[model samples]
Target: MTTLETPVPAGHRSLRQRAGNAGRRTTSDKVFNAVLTIAMVIAMVPLFVIIGYVTYRGIGVIGWDFFTLEEPPYRRAGGGYVAGFFGTLYIMGLAILMAVPLGIATAIYVVEYGQGKLAMAIRFFSDVMTGIPSIFVGLFVYGLMVSGWISVGFGTFVAAVAIAIIMLPIVTRSAEEMLKLVPDEWRNASYGLGAGKAQTILKTVLPAAAPGLITGSMLAIARGIGETAPLILTALGSVFIVTTLQGDPQAAVPLQIYNGARQPFEEGLNRAFGGALSLFVLVLIMVVAARIIGARANKRK
Candidate 1:
């Protein structure tokens, strides 16, 4: 038997040559790094400017008394934003109560259970809803409760509902992404131990995803707190603190800011600046809290 020598294919040699050529055609990664740094700075510049402006204008007015005093009658002459502060907390707490469970549950179903046309449609609509303008949400709620067929019962509850609608899709999408990040091995291990769906989700998936959920919730709270137009249409900005869910018009920080800012009085404008500063501080605090919570959770993990 004659031994035949195998030929090295031209294609293989070409590929090797190309790979070598590509390896030699290197550029310094510094250009990319420079572009990334510049992009980040550009993005952050506007945010810093706004926060700096608000702090500069409002810091003189923000004080310990700002938290304890009531809204000044002169809009700039008397007390602080104590009532507006409590009202904001109340409305946002109620909105969270209305939004979290429903949002998380919807997220779970979409992520783990739904697999057919209905899931696709739900997801498509969720994307659309998440991008819809807040003004439109305000208009829809206003129509339903303020002036539409159900005109008889609009108040804080109505405002909460509107905010819930605004916040739900955000919470759901974030939670779904977080839950999806839980490794399949975790779920598989639970299944190996004969765990039921509910037990697996409760014990394995949710704890792993807690950080993201908390962060999303904080964002929701921040978003709801600064909202003015929606609450203005639905809650109508009461002069005094509201006691009941169905109580008369309720004032919130955002609405108070709008009211004070629009008035002709110099005191009112100062109060508006002060209110904006307070809001900025509150948002910053919440963001810090979220970061802390996320860091702790990650450390535990």
Candidate 2:
């Protein structure tokens, strides 16, 4: 049998040569870059404007007293967000407690132990959970936690649980991605040293992935802090200082802004602006702290 050989064409060879000989980015690339730059600036302008306006309007009211006082009906007669601040802290503490373990554990299973139909199901549920609205989470907690046994309707604890649900999927997805970034060579090396699967994962993999995991956790916390819809449904609203999570209704900074901004009082408007500015600062501090911690952890290695 004769073998048929195909000869390469000069046109194709010249086309390839010309393609390889092409120089720098043409006009199209520069135009694309210009458009992208404009798009990014446009996307960022509203955020900057909001922060700037709030700071300009509220900086004078921001103080230690502003953080320590209650929101009395008399508006400026009372001081800061002592109850709101403490309530935020309390709710966030509970949310972290609930979200971290569950999120990390789920991430571990998805990354390490996941297989077959079980893995598929877990991934599907996780994706669904991530898309779920915060308001829906609040309603769910209201049904199970509020209407069922606790019968407290709306309170700080319920609000915390709602926030936990919102944060759980974010932390889990972040952790899973972080864990996946761990090098397989490192894992193999650990195994070569007689480390079992669990041991390799706990000692070698986890430490390497800690920075990403913590960064994810911080994002989750930041998201939880600014959430308004969930807290509105689960925590309701309270003007007085709330010392405990179980007994009294607790107001969040977002809730305070919502309630205060609608009133005709000038002081209420000022307080709302101040609260918005304070929340922005708090979120900013958290993001910065996360970056610092992540950097330190990386340096320690």
Candidate 3:
């Protein structure tokens, strides 16, 4: 024992070399982190600026009448966004009813059962649909439902359909991604337990992706409500809120805001800002609620 010693390996790095390399890596990490943080801040600047300006202009315009009464004429000042507000709710509700189920179902087909040309075509068309401009969708609906084609004329139901077109792609894509995130092990386990394909999908896969599906649906709803072009061509904008699915044109927040902004009166401009603010608040509430629900669902899972 006093004389015997093992020879050192030729390629073994010394402690000092390893320490220096680790320090260099840590420094590189810090540099990358700082750069990414700066990039994030830069990206956020415009959003913050727009929010601040909108809030400043809109805060003083909110009154009880501003929210509860019919929007006033361009030169008039005592009315509210009541009609458009309700119209937005009605249209958004119908659109959600029409879109979410179809989107989720399409997502399921693509993720679980789709194969070969069918699946490829679905994914291609979904991406294509996402890129289709809102105005084009409006035009198509107008041509089909409003013009001599179907003669449905301007109705909230048609408007809801137009919005649904805009929302479908978003919901489908989001849901597909979410469903894909569920662990394959879970599916294997379910099958291992003798579960049928439909049973496993319904009982295991969907539950795992529920939070994301819900969140994505909420976001799609938000976008649908704010769609002005589709509504213009389909809903056609009413002076008063129409409560029925088939009726005289329905008013919506976006239509009102757009008209207000284009009017030649200070009152109209102010009202436009107020409408924008209200829409912002409503969307914020929905998004926040979605986040809360998603968090809870994730925890439960």
What TM-score goes with each of the models? Answer: 0.86, 0.87, 0.88
Residues 192-276 of candidate 1 have per-residue lDDT tens digits of 9999999999999998898989898788777777888888888888667787886478778888889887888877777778899
Candidate whose TM-score is highest? 3
C-alpha lDDT (0 to 100) for residue 299 of candidate 2 = 83
> lDDT of each model, Cα atoms only?
0.82, 0.85, 0.90
For candidate 2, lDDT tens digit of each residue in 188-243?
99999999999999999998998989998998999899998888878887877676
Question: Total clashing residue pairs per candidate?
Answer: 1, 1, 0
Give model 1's TM-score versus the native structure. 0.86
Ranking by TM-score: 3, 2, 1
What lDDT tens digits, residue by residue, belong to model 3 across residues 44-122? 9999998888888787788888888997678977688899989988988899999999999999999999987898898
lDDT of 2 at 150: 68
Q: How accurate is candidate 2 locally (lDDT)?
A: 0.85
- The order by descending lDDT is 3, 2, 1
Q: Top lDDT: which candidate number?
A: 3
- Cα-based lDDT at residue 10, candidate 1: 66
For model 2, the run of ten residues with the poorest summed lDDT? 14-23
Better of 1 and 3 by lDDT: 3
Global fold similarity of model 2 (TM-score): 0.87
User: Root-mean-square deviation of each candidate, in angstroms?
Assistant: 5.3, 6.1, 3.2
